[model samples]
Target: MQITDFSVDQNLKELTEHRTVVLPVACYVTTISENINGYIPLHWHDELQFIHVVKGTANFQINEEPVAIREGEGLFINSGCLHMAKDENSTGCVYICLNVSPNFVVSHELFTTFVSPYIQATNLQYLHLVPKDAWASNILESIRTIEQYIHQSQPFYEIEVSIELTSIWKNLVKNGIQLEFKERETLKNQRMKRMLNWIHQHYAEKILLEDIALAGQLSRSECCRYFKRYLNKSPLNYVTDYRIQKSQILLQQPQYSVTDVAYQVGFNSTSYFIEKFRKAMNMTPFEYKKYRN
Candidate 1:
């Protein structure tokens, strides 16, 4: 609930710490807003995820391509896919993100027959469900229904939630397109995940492109190209942006001065940090802290 710094390993697998948030049920639902940081940084988990854009628009970068879901639209991200979410145009958006562990959904032996092929289809990173389409609208409604039941928490809500999920899986298997896995895609994802994990680990230190490349075992040029191809940002630029975002949590506290927060998040130059902070947040650190309070 505190929206703590992301907990991930060298492989970029988020430790979701589901034990605390998801103790009673295998499913977890929450809403995300740009105010939290404007983006959910690249991370992956073993559970399946569904996102419904309730207001404004959300841009989800899955694998590498960006898919924009407008209000009333929904998206499904398969398990183990590298992805990130942000508000489109920073207009502020509200989206429900739900993660359901595999164990919760595949209770019976026959369920595997329905879901295994798609999960194994490495090329299918996500599915965008638009309300205008017929089958997609049906899936969208099912997601909404599940959300409603979870929020209401009436008696037998769990049973109702499972029924809706079953319908969603059945429809997805019937209508979803299968992606063709290229020879290099698997290796590419692995390399990207490793690089991302390394960034998350050492962001508070002075990290260079060479250091990030080492995590992925690539040369400097190769690393830049890889990030450009997948994340569309240079390694150093990404590191700076990440450091600025991480500084927000510190800024929210009263004890850490602006300069201290900047240095704590790996920014060596306070002036440079303020410039980037203003560029990303449209306010000075002092202004943001005062406004937040």
Candidate 2:
């Protein structure tokens, strides 16, 4: 399998790289320490995903809830769920990621009955798969087998992989039907995504708490509460963090001086920007730029 990095657009939807046009599926390995931020940034996609931790432990924030999957454990993320992952131990983490389009796995008739319901179920955001559980173990094993088949590329591997994927889907539907419904939580998650998207788009501008709340159609207090709940930070803090992240890219360009990067990323004062950047990255902008170069 390919080792790849993730890229996302303004809406935070991941631009996934597929293995083949016909299959609409991709399997790859990623190391948490290798990412730009030492973690996978928050993003979502329409495809369903399964992640198996191969080394160390992976800490994930899925739809604002924290879940940890250790070595030999796996996780199933529903379609379009906002999620991010990082290494829990700080040593590093190796994991296999499989992304598959739901439509490719089932026929139109079966999709309406067996697939759409689970994908559209707001309360069913993710499932943490552990090897100790019989059913969960079966699913994890199937995921491993699918990866092996794809990597080996033997004759009729596509057909064999399809059968394995279909079996996984059946098991997911059978088990996920029991989760309790919580439409309110789902709506909150959607609002949070809207606010996050606005922050990413407007990070280069002077953003206010009111602007963020307005983007999400929420009251200022509600906005603050949601940001704290979902991101564990105040809205303004999140904005500062985002601006610092953006500034790191501009720092790489020799044409842009430290002062220029600070202003470009919405900081009015270079000293203030340096202060924040150091706190977040443990290095000043100039130091980081020099190290990167």
lDDT of each: 0.77, 0.84
Across 1-293, the per-residue lDDT of candidate 1 in tens digits comes to 22425666656688765422332223334334533575677778887887777777888898887999888998989988988877758656676666776556655686567666667676778989888877778888887787777777788887887788777777777675755767587788888888988998899998988999999999999999989977899999988887887788889899999999999999998899999999987898889888766
Candidate 1 similarity to native, TM-score? 0.87
**Could you estimate the TM-score for every candidate?**
0.87, 0.93
Off by over 4 Å in 1: 1-12, 15-34, 90-92, 179-183
lDDT of 1: 0.77
Q: Which stretches of candidate 2 lie over 4 Å from their true place?
A: 1-5, 179-182
Write the residue-wise lDDT of candidate 2 on 1-293 in tens digits: 44435667877888766655457888888788787666787789999998888888999988878899999999999988998887857857888888899886776789888888788777788999888877788788888888898888888999988998898887676664565557787788789889988988988888999999998999999999988777788999989988887887888898999999999999999999999999988888999999877
Best by TM-score: 2
